[model samples]
Every structure is written in C-alpha cells, then in structure tokens.
Target: MSYKPAHAGSGPASNSLRILETVARFGTGTTAKEITDALRMPPATAYRLLNALVGDEYLVRTSDLRGFALGHALSGLVAAATPPTVCTAARTIIDEFRQGVRFAVHLMMFRSASLRVAEEDPDYPLHSVFELLRYPHASAAGKLMLAELGDPALALPGGQLVKVTDHTITDSGRLEEQLAEIRVAGQASEINELEEGSASLALPVQLPDGSAGAALCLTGPAERFTAISEHAEAARELTVRLKPLLF
Candidate 1:
C-alpha cells in the first residue's frame, strides 16, 4: 500500500499537490511529464511547483531522478491527523454482541470530555452521534461520560442545556443530581430525552483511575426501556470484555 493524504483540495498549493497526487495514484517512479499530462497543467506551472515541493521536502525525486515519490514530510502530517483504529479482535467481540441484541448497540470511547463512536450497530444506525456528543446531557452514553468526568459543568457548553426533546434535562442542578446518581450506580439511562420515542441505557468501561474510558450503550424504542434494563448484567459483562481493547 502507498501513503494517502487525509485531506485534499484546490488552493495556492493545488498545482504542487496535484503533481504529488498524480505520483501517489501512480505509485513511485512517476515522471514530471506524466504529472503535467494527467493534471493538464502547462509545463512551466507544473515544473515550478514540482521544484518548490521538492525543495520544501513535500516531495522527493526518484533515486535515478527520472521520476518522483512522496516525501518523508508527509509522515508527520499523517501521524498527527490519524485517529486510532479498532483491531480485528475488538471488532469480533463487539460484533457478537451486536448480532445478539435487538437494540442499537454503540461502543464509544472517551477522549478528554468528548465521546467518539468506536463502533455503531449496523442493523440500527445511530440517530446522530455529533448532536448527542454536543449535548452530553441528552443521551445515556453522554450522561455516563459526564458522570465519570465528575463535573457536568466541564462537559456542558455555555448557556442552558439545549432541549432536544421536552424530556431533555435543561437545568444544570438537576443534571448534576443525576450525574451523582450515576456515580453511585455505575450506569446511566435516558428516556425520551434525545428523541420522543427513543430511550437508551449506558454502562461504563471503567479505567484504572476510576473514570470511564469507554461506554457500551443499548438503545431502542422508549416503550422498551424495561427491555433495556433486563440486559444490565450482559452490558456489564460486555464492558469487562472490552476493557482490554477500548482504553
């Protein structure tokens, strides 16, 4: 496999980037003439940017100087932007539970105060991970994360908690009270908070420091919340199974 840029587009750097992209797509040993032909850029424009890129270490000339290859400079940029990936073993474990459950099971990792989806159920897609993370007080997984942080205020954005549904907790005092309960109970639940007829329950994958490193949330129709609670033992077992991979 070859290096691929995480970002790309037109700008002052477009011509130079186009040349590098041409080389990447064609792999190493791609000639300058090939780049210009593929990009349909004038020879002068292509050559100028190519030279500038080579000089700046964004590209490198081939060992024989007959072509170009991606330069080492790209390594730093790629490493900085790349997020961690779930391994095969972790996926297998998560998949087994997802296959057995009727609910939308999501595995979310906590990075600082934010929760990022590690994996979402394929059969039932999540409503909106972005919106849920933005309003951590509105979802079971988000509430579990906030409780683990031990400070709801740190996770809450400025102003009142935005009301996604009438059942959503809008008051900080009330949210804090729930967070306290979660701290004691080691789990969190939501009812018609994020959506009118949806509910969820979350159990933490706790870390050595006693804060949650990840969460396993089960979501389904609001009427089936009792069904969600029936799996508390199963969710706890799943979290223990995931502890080796998630944190």
Candidate 2:
C-alpha cells in the first residue's frame, strides 16, 4: 500500500500550510502578492488564508502592514524545531562587536530585495525594529547591499527611494551616485538619513564567491558618527573582526 502526504494537493488546509512555508522561506517576510505569485493561488484565496493565519496567531502582519511574518506561535514552533548553534554564533559575534564598539550592532542579510536583521544588539536599540525593513534606501546597510547589486538593485521596491527624513536621498539620480561611492569606498554610512538623531555605518561581509553575503552595521546617535574619519576607522575595525567569523 502507498501513502500520500496530506499537503500534496490543493485544499484549504494544504494551501494554508503552503502559505506558511512560503512566508517562512522569505527571510524578510512576504507580501500577499508574493504569496499569490509563488503558489499560483487565486488572490482572493490567498488573502483569506493569510487573514485566517494572522487571526489564529500563526502569522503576523509586518509593522508596516505591507507583509506577513511568522507570529509568536509559529516562531516558537520554528525555534523548537531547529538547532540553536547558528543563533548562538550570530549572537556571540554581535555581542562582541557591541561590547567593542559601545554601539548598537546589527547583522543584516539582503535577500529577495529585502533587508532582514538576523541578529541585533538588544541592549541598545537605535530605530524602530521595522524601520530597516520599511526604509532600506535610507540606511547604510541597505545602501551597501544595493551597491553590491549594482544596476539591477534599482528595480527593487525600496529603490523608489522614499524619503524617510529630511536627509534622505529621494532623488534616484543622487541615490545612484551615493551607491557608486559606497561601492568604491567598500563601506557605507548614513547620517540623519533614516532618522533625525541617528546614524549608521555598514560594511559588507564578502562571501566565498566574492559577493556580499551580509552587512555588518553599527548605529548610534548622529553626534557620535558625524565625523568621517571616525566612521571609517570603526567600520574598518569591525569589518576585520567580522570577516574571520562570518566568511
């Protein structure tokens, strides 16, 4: 006798499970349209399932209300199912950097045109946790990833360059120039861009294939990061320490 998997075909339960899986795969959460396109499910059906999942605490809408991520219940499930070694290593590295720099540190991975914070310094929070996801164009780590992506990165939704603050670079032409500079400099910095009082410095973690695997960032009060020489020095030091651990 042969047995069939419960999720092998289309049904309310099967589709719900598939939607959960799809959202999980997206490191930075996913939009409704993305779910529809990925699963080839009807838009109405997708929305209904998403709403149900959100209501049942299996999924939670992003802080921007534009995407969905694993909710508390689902996150706990995933945590219980996976090993803790990777999380431990990530936290150790971030903690060490935070201790050395005395600033908030974050580990960000750019995937599927989104910036996902894999780990962050809990002792010192800079901006709203969701702010990075919503305003990638206004952040140093985001600019670094965009620089690595080159022209193709411009097609991402964040490439619209929404102005998050008065200092944000909303003009596409100017933003492109900034990206170029970051590429040449091998690092990126933003002062009062994402927020009025905050600044950040980011450097790329070079992968084995010579591509940017992730971004290591330090953020703090704008006053502390306003000096170019200081920013460069800190970024260089952090990059040296991160390279051995991450790559």
lDDT of every model, 2 decimals: 0.81, 0.75
- Give every collision pair in model 2: none
User: What tens-digit string does per-residue lDDT give for candidate 2 at 47-142?
Assistant: 999999999999998889999988887775665444223346656656765666667777786655457776666887556656677677788888
lDDT of 1: 0.81
Which parts of model 2 have CA positions greater than 4 angstroms off? 1-87, 152-155, 227-247
Q: After superposition, how far is residue 59 of candidate 1 from its true place, in Å?
A: 26
- Please report the candidate that would top lDDT against the real structure: 1
Q: Point to the candidate with the largest TM-score.
A: 1
lDDT of 1 at 21: 73
Superposed on all Cα atoms, the candidates' RMSDs to the truth, in angstroms, are 8.5, 11.8
TM-score of decoy 2:
0.61
Model 1 C-alpha lDDT per residue in residues 1-247, reported as the tens digit of each score: 2322333444547666667778889988898878776776667767888888889887899899999888878754554345546778878988888777788888877766776777878888889666787888999999998887777776777735889889999988999899899989999999999888999999998777667888889999999999888988988998888777755
